[model samples]
Structures are given as C-alpha cells and as structure tokens.
Target: MTGAGGNPAPSLPGRFGPSFDVRTVVVEPGGSRVYDEAEWRGAIVLLERGRIELVCSDGGRRAFGRGDVLWLEGLPVRALHNPGREPAVLLAISRRPARR
Candidate 1:
C-alpha cells in the first residue's frame, strides 16, 4: 500500500531507517493505484504500464504506455489512474540500500 504522500512503504527491513527496495506492481486498465512517500525507503520506483496515467499530489500527471519506464522518488505519490479503455498493466521496481 501507499503512504501519506504518493509513495509505497519501504520494505520490512527498511522500516527502521534509510534503505532501498525493488518491487513490481501491476495496474489494470481503468484502475488506479496510490503509493505513499514515507513508505518509500529512498528508492526510485520504476513503473511500466500499458496505457495508464500517473498522478502526483502536486497535480502532476503523465500518461504511459507499454514498455515505458516511470521513475518515482521518496516523495509521497498522489494517485495512479487507468482510463479503463483497455487493461493497463504496470511493473514497478524500487531500488535502495538497506539501512545499517
């Protein structure tokens, strides 16, 4: 699940402090997703979707298609939108180092 901002929660090991993680997420067509900022362990989340819209808390929106790579920082993510015209799928990877 996403955190307060628009980022997902960091991995279990990162709950304590700064760390990194990689994850894969899927977004169906006409569906929407949210990722909280604090949940992110300072990792950049790479997303690949099939015709979907990425929404940010600051009202920043981006449309992505298949084979597209979207990057997310440790800032709270607002929302992810799928128009529903077709099924949209997303693969997300978060990269960060474990906290010592």
Candidate 2:
C-alpha cells in the first residue's frame, strides 16, 4: 500500500499491487528465527527496529540496521538473529498466493 500522497505500490505479475500482504516480525534480544528457504521466497523486508543479522548456510553473516530494505528471495540465509540488546522488528511484504 502507498503512503499518504506517496507513489503507488509497484505492479505485480499474477496480481495487483494491493494484493500483497505484510507481516510484522519481532526478534527478541539474542533470539533467532530459522529462515525456511521457501517461506521467504519473493519476500521484501524492511528493518524497523534495532539490528539484525542474516546467518548464511555457509557460516557467513550479514548485518542490517533500521531503515534497511531487504530482498530475501533466492538467498541462502539459515536464520535471522537479533544481535542487539533490544528487540528488533521488521515488516515482511510478500505477494499473497493465488487461491484455487
């Protein structure tokens, strides 16, 4: 969805822009969430609070701070971790799957 007087959401393939869904995720201090490969496919994420790190399958890691946008599609990350003392929050936007 677009913000007040902001540019409209970009067009999508199988559906319109407004058909996408947003999920708010909270990562507690020192906590982690396993990233199932398929779960984040085509997902767009925005980091809103604190800091987070993406732990890759190859034992590498990348950190992101607030206001950073992420495209996790096709990434080999194994988990998302909150490396700061406070909680980290993020918004994940993904297109809603087609219904039967």
Candidate 3:
C-alpha cells in the first residue's frame, strides 16, 4: 500500500524494518524473458548462476555474471537474456507492500 507523500508502505513495520519478498527468475540457454518492472521496481537482483544480459530500452545493453548483485530501480531495462549455454538463475528481492 501507499503511505503519506505517496511512498510505499512496508509490510512489516517497526524496529526490524520492512519485510521482503523473493522470487526466482530463470533464463534458459539462449533464451530471453521480459523483466517484471512493475513488481520489481525497487528490487535487488542477485545473479545466482550463469550469466545475464540486459537489453535496455534506449538501445544499450549490460551484462552480469554469477554472484553479482544489482538494483533495477529507475533503470531503463527492457528484457533479460542468457547469452551462455546454461540456464541463468536470479533472485529478485522486493519489499512486501503493506496490507490493507
């Protein structure tokens, strides 16, 4: 949910701070997948295995390898593809929205 000033409210409030939700994303060898920008707007993505390449909306591209961590917020990323011959795994961690 949204809080004052139109910011996102956390699912778990208080001392420990916000709760997080994690999702697994796997891209097969030579395969591509659309990035879920809406759900992962401010997410932290961790490359678990293999490699990942981002296709940018502005015609640019970037690549990441295993054990790499990145934030996708405000990034103009369009799609994610695996350039290697093995499947790539990533963990997307995002804040859990407050309940109504």
lDDT (CA) for every model shown? 0.56, 0.77, 0.75
Worst 10 residues of 1 by lDDT: 9-18
Q: Which of 2 and 3 is ahead in TM-score?
A: 2
* Top candidate, metric lDDT: 2
Query: Candidate 3 on 9-46: residue-level lDDT in tens?
Result: 43322323457766666678899888666756777877
Tens digits of per-residue lDDT for model 2, 10-97: 2322242567786667778899989876766777887867899999999999999998999887888899999999878777788778
TM-score of each: 0.52, 0.73, 0.71
By TM-score rank, best first, the candidates go 2, 3, 1
Residue 41 local lDDT, model 2: 70
**TM-score, predicted candidate 1 vs. hidden true structure:** 0.52
Native-referenced Cα lDDT, model 1: 0.56
| Backbone clash count for every predicted candidate, in the order shown | 21, 0, 0
Better of 1 and 2 by TM-score: 2
Best by TM-score: 2
